[model samples]
Target: MKGNVNSPLHSDYLNNKMKSVQRRHSELKHATPHKLRHTRATLAKQAGTSIEAISEALTHSDTITTKTYVNASNVIPMAVGEIAYRNLKK
Candidate 1:
């Protein structure tokens, strides 16, 4: 239950809380909400989440904008190699 609507948690409060919680962890030195959001988006993309789904989850008006937000690493090289091998074998 929100005790105070006037005192609702905002970005600064969330950022401060994040800093306080991560103060002891040197590895999380640059953990801000923006970075965390991007990381989540990237992870979702890597986990095979559809761009349209990601866009809706992120509340983006345009799917193209969501495409720019995701940072996924995949196996294009391996797929290309397999295709080449199949073509060469025929």
Candidate 2:
């Protein structure tokens, strides 16, 4: 609430809050919302989230754009055939 009124939080307010928290916390010195988002995307990709899903979550035009946020190299492509084969083994 901006100045005792109900309202959406602005980016400046968020940034200022982030800075204030960072000042009190030594480990969060370089942390920002954008970096946290990128980290979440990368970690989600590493945790087996599909590129399509990630793209949708990020509201990107396509998966190609999402690839930039996700660590592409660490993501192993699991083809449909491979998934089928794994399921058959089980």
Candidate 3:
């Protein structure tokens, strides 16, 4: 699964790594590259990261696609924007 110098890691490599992890951790049996990406996006959203930032981080051309990655039901109850703003002020 090794890639040539300067080349991106193949999806198969990541998938294999994920499978190995799942073998060791039964709780992660449902994990996959796409699921991991979605989880990261949701976490970033819950952490008060701007949607545009998340979209850019995910290399999405439009926020609409990134929106689907975020799990709205898992959002924090606090004001995420306010928390982010306060962090910026610090």
Candidate 4:
């Protein structure tokens, strides 16, 4: 199965594979592929990447769609705040 990119897994195959994997790992109950994508986006946001960058990386059709991934703790607002504070002190 490893290093077999030429044999791309189909949707049905992936679903069946996930079923088998989930049975082996009971803790993974209710997990789905979409959840994995959301997790990836959230982690990227937490890592300080801008929403626009994330949007592009995710191939989002609109920026507003990507804004769903934005969080207050993400790096963008913090960086803006820092710059504002520095200017105020100057």
Candidate 5:
């Protein structure tokens, strides 16, 4: 209140005013957007979301890219993951 609104001290207040408005939005200060994208695609695949849909959601030009993301945690994609699960159920 001591300084004019145009003064340097007031500028700091203006700069941080928007920050105090929201507390939950700061969680991304440490988030990895790319890793979240890959994890979401992989989980969607496990939940049986269509590959074409996952590709479109990821803005990928090819479904192969989505498949790569979904299978990044494994090797050989369904050839390994699906076969292992299927054999386990037998």
Candidate 6:
């Protein structure tokens, strides 16, 4: 069935749909929509996208909310390492 943004499928429905796709493909694990969102944010940060841009794309009402999505587990150390390597080259 066609669904709009406001008429979005329920989380359970989405999860079940993902599970069905995984089963069909013999894939053991499928990332949930939320995890996918986090991964997008993390990758965007790593790719040098600004926090403000990521926050806007994610439609976060507050930048702090976006910051929470940009976790140390995802982006911080990699950025630091890149900077360290850049400095080493100089």
Pairwise TM-score winner, candidates 1 and 3: 3
- Give the per-residue lDDT digits (tens) of candidate 6, residues 21-75: 8888875666788977887988878766788999998889877888888764656
For model 5, how does the per-residue alpha-carbon lDDT over 1-90 read when each residue is reduced to its tens digit? 565643344545644654564355775443344566787898767655678998987889999777778865553345556756766898
- Candidate 3: where is the Cα deviation over 4 Å? 1-7, 77-90
Instruction: Give the TM-score comparing model 2 with the true structure, all chains together.
Output: 0.62
Clashing residue pairs in candidate 6 (N, C-alpha, C atoms within 3 angstroms): none
Root-mean-square deviation per candidate: 10.2, 7.9, 4.7, 8.7, 14.6, 7.0
The local distance difference test score of each candidate is 0.71, 0.76, 0.86, 0.69, 0.66, 0.78
Q: Please identify model 4 stretches exceeding 4 Å from their true place.
A: 1-9, 69-90
TM-score of each: 0.65, 0.62, 0.75, 0.58, 0.45, 0.60
Worst 10 residues of 1 by lDDT: 71-80
Instruction: Judging by TM-score against the true structure, name the best candidate.
Output: 3
Candidate 3 positional error at 39, Å: 0.2
Off by over 4 Å in 5: 1-31, 72-90
Q: Which is the winner by lDDT between candidate 2 and candidate 6?
A: 6
- Give the candidate order by descending lDDT: 3, 6, 2, 1, 4, 5
The alpha-carbon deviation from the true structure for residue 58 of candidate 6, after best TM-score superposition, in angstroms, is: 0.5
Off by over 4 Å in 1: 1-9, 73-90
lDDT of 1 by residue, 1-90 (tens): 378744546898898889887887767567788777677777666645667888887778988887777764541223556656756888
Give candidate 1's error at residue 85 in angstroms. 29
lDDT of 4 at 10: 73
